[model samples]
Target: MKDVQTCLNAMTVDVEDFFHVSAFDKIIKPQDWDQYQPRVDGNTRRLLDIFSRHGVKSTFFVLGWVAERYPELIKEIHAQGHEIASHGYAHRRATEQDRQTFLADVRRSKNHLEDLLGEAVIGYRAPSFSIGYSNEWAFEVLAELGFSYSSSTYPVKHDLYGTPDWPRFAYQRAEQIMEIPIPTLKMMGRQIPIGGGGYFRLYPYALTHYLVNKYLDKEKQPYSFYFHPWEIDADQPRLNNASAKSRFRHYVNLQHTESKLDRLLQDFRWSTMKDVYGVNV
Candidate 1:
């Protein structure tokens, strides 16, 4: 086994509620998001408590909408010594927005987080890993807004968002901001995603453990994992109107996520994105 204390990886939380997910965007409009019960505060606090127990510090890529409504929650997260980053305003995908709109969205979120934390918020992860080849200009916008790095691209093939040709590891973009693609393992000439999110919940704990170990041993790089605040909240309201695929992806194994995360935390050392990648925020 790899020495847990020596292999520091990045743990990130996309601080959005169940309604904010892109999977439900077609069914649940952003303007109607207020109608949903505010469960993010409780769910996120639960995650914070879990991290506290395990002595882990993670980066929270918070939505501007959530931060606005739960400013105290944002303060509490920062007070706990977790890194505060942006998940853009309204959870709009970068691919869905024009360059100008994308810039405005990210800037709005970053400014809100910085205002709450009283520090620079430099890291960004696009909604749904939405920054792909067509919207590569998004990187220039991120750079122009003074973001130090972005974990906005998934270099694996996926139905919603991915650029299989993008670098599978952290690489500096020509636009000047560091682009940290979500971690994947190349096997049988394919990039298998082992980073986290629905994939983490879908796979059994033992399989995930083996795959993560394989990635670490073969790649010899930090494994960055991400999941949403609602992943652990099995009791959260379900959008029955969403597509069958979306519902399955969002709701599958909800009860097991927290336990799996606890194991993941104990299995490896974790830190903020800035710390793991040596990026200044």
Candidate 2:
């Protein structure tokens, strides 16, 4: 194993409540989002505390809807020295909208976050890593809106979202926009996702650890890992009405995520995406 302690990786949190996840969209309408109790503030604060204990700074992609409801939470994240970036005004995927609609969604989010921080919020991640070949235009929209970089693409195959053929590392997408894909490992002539998400929860921590270390040692590049606040909240209300597959994906190994995350933090050196990728925002 490589001495991962010497290499800094990018740690990120998608700051949204469980109900905001796309898997529950069919069961939980956006209009009825208020009906569900909000657990993101507490869950995210829990992550912030964990990051603090490990002396790790992460980028938080704040959803505009959450910022609108919990302004103090957004401010608290910034106060604690984490980079604040946009997760769009709503959780709508870029693939589901037209170019104009997508533009409006991101613009509203960027403006909202900037209004909160009193500084430009130049980093963005599309909901669910939703940007792909079909919606490549989204990058132009992101650039048009003054974003410095986007960690919005995953270069692996998945039923939900993935641009398997996209660059696996940071590359410029537009004049001022850089697209940083989540880290993956090339194995058996295919890309295996080692970056965090449901895969972190699904696999044994030992396996995840090995893959991450392998990627770091072989790729010789900073790995970026992401997870949602809800992933650690095992007790968050369950939407049983949603499909079984969605529930399984959302709730699988929830009880163990926090502990696993703590271990992951202790095992790796971490910093914000801006610092790791040298993106000016």
| TM-score of each candidate structure, all chains considered together | 0.98, 0.98
Go through the candidates in order and give each one's C-alpha lDDT.
0.91, 0.91
Q: Write the per-residue lDDT of candidate 2 for residues 28-105, one digit (tens) a residue.
A: 888998887899999988888898898889999999999988899999999999999999988998899999999998
| Best model number under lDDT | 1
Residue-wise lDDT of candidate 1 within 1-281, one digit each (tens)? 55434678999999999999988989999889888888999999999999999999999999999999999999999999999999999888888899888988888888888888889999999999999878889989999999999999999889899999978889998899998889999899989999999999999998888888888888888889999999999999878888999999999999999999999999888999999999985
Question: Residue 38's C-alpha lDDT in candidate 1?
Answer: 86
Give the runs in model 1 whose Cα sits over 4 Å from its true position.
1-5
